[model samples]
Target chain A: MIRHVAVFRFVPEFTTEHREHWMALVRALPDRIPQLRSMTVGADVLRGPASYELAIVADFDDLDGLEAYTRHPAHAEVLRISAPVKASLATVDFEIPDAS
Target chain B: MIRHVAVFRFVPEFTTEHREHWMALVRALPDRIPQLRSMTVGADVLRGPASYELAIVADFDDLDGLEAYTRHPAHAEVLRISAPVKASLATVDFEIPDAS
Candidate 1:
């Protein structure tokens, strides 16, 4: 298994209202990607001296599943809508071992 | 690799002050758990209709490494401090696929 974590840092300018709009776009992703087994989106409350503002957690069966999601058309839409509101984006991809 | 995610929800009574105390306790753990490869802690900003208040992301070399950290003396101290303020706690232990 593999988990893909995309961390985004939004500028203070976006503030409260902007996130709601971005969230709407995010909510539409799961239906678009079949390989996304689990996904969770969250905002960072402890923003003190940190560069990340939001986090997207996605669990997949393997690297290929993660790759499919990354290339899916739906993800691009999210990026397009998010382009204006976000200040920066960073990603960390790691593998998950089998339970047995 | 194995990722241990501890999701916690704190009641409104917690507010800002309580988290600072918990964070201090958290920063001290890495020093004590050599098996703890990486750790990230964040507070939820959306505050929407969710039960989670804090999310802790930890990466370990494998399951044994995770166990070592769990049994380490420092982890006990965290539980003691957290026993009071938390409303609920949930954990998901996942294995990471090897690079090779």
Candidate 2:
């Protein structure tokens, strides 16, 4: 499996309602994007100095599955909402070895 | 459960050996730190414009367990190895709702 992890810091002007709407869209992605094997989306509970505002961890069978999800219209919709309000974003894509 | 996710960008000077040694230590953390329920560490497969070089996703029973893992000597040891070589680090701690 491949894991895709993204952390986001929202712009200071992004309101509670905006966050709720964005998070809802992200949480609904697996249902809309068939390539997602599993996904978890959450708001950061600890607003520490190094903390980002939100995170999503999603799993795919392979890079092709991940690419499919990335190009899916549902994901683009979420990204459209995110792009304007995001202060910064960082992502990591990595392979997950099967259990020994 | 609480999920702690961290993304790191290593300094330009950090070499392959440094990464392997650091990864070995981090992969050994779950065994050394009993507070960790589960952990996954990986080097980034896609070095995209917004990519971070490494990422870790770990789960704990609660904030207390997370705190214990953060304060553990073994974790400190890993930090010592990571601190100087890490150009940037970002973290998010959030609640993972139980599956319905």
Candidate 3:
């Protein structure tokens, strides 16, 4: 399986409502995108000096499924909404061995 | 629960064996550290331009639990082994609300 993680650090001015707005879109994703096997969106509770405000961790069957989920319209809309508020974005897409 | 993720990009000279060497210690973590509720260590299958070579995704009951895991002797040994091979490390620690 492929694990795709994307984390976003919001602009200093972004508010809780703005974060919830993005999270709502993320929460609604599994139903909208057929390739999304599992997804979790969470806010950072331990806001240390290096903390990121929001993160999304999702799994896909393979690279193709991950690509499809990225290209979905809902994802596009999320990108559009996040453009103004995002300060930094970090992501990783990697494959894991099949469970024995 | 608190989610703690750590990703490592190894030096160009690091080999699969070095990765496995580290992973072996990681795989042995939950047994050594009672606070580590769940842990997954995997090599990156996707070698994209921005790929990180190894990653550890682990969950803890709370911030204190996460801290204890980090301070565990086995974990410290893993860190010692990784020092020579590690190129870059990126980590994120955050709290997620109860799954209702």
Name the candidate, 2 or 3, with the larger lDDT value.
2
Off by over 4 Å in 1: A1-100
Retained true contacts (fraction), each candidate = 0.00, 0.76, 0.32
Candidate 2: list runs displaced more than 4 Å: none
lDDT of 3 by residue, A17-87 (tens): 88888888988899999999888787877676556677777889999999899799988998888888888
Q: For model 3, what is the alpha-carbon lDDT of residue A65?
A: 95
Model 1, range B1-100, lDDT digits (tens) per residue?
6666666767678768777778667766777789988776656533434335676677789878977987988888887777777776545454444551
lDDT of 2 by residue, A11-81 (tens): 98998788888888888898999899888888899889889999999999999999999999999999898
Worst window of 10 by summed lDDT in candidate 1 chain B: B42-51
Candidate that would win on DockQ? 2
Tell me the DockQ of each model, to 2 decimals: 0.04, 0.86, 0.46
CA lDDT, every model vs. true structure: 0.67, 0.90, 0.79
- How large an RMSD does model 1 have? 13.7
Question: What DockQ score does model 2 reach against the true complex?
Answer: 0.86
- Per-candidate TM equals 0.51, 0.96, 0.86
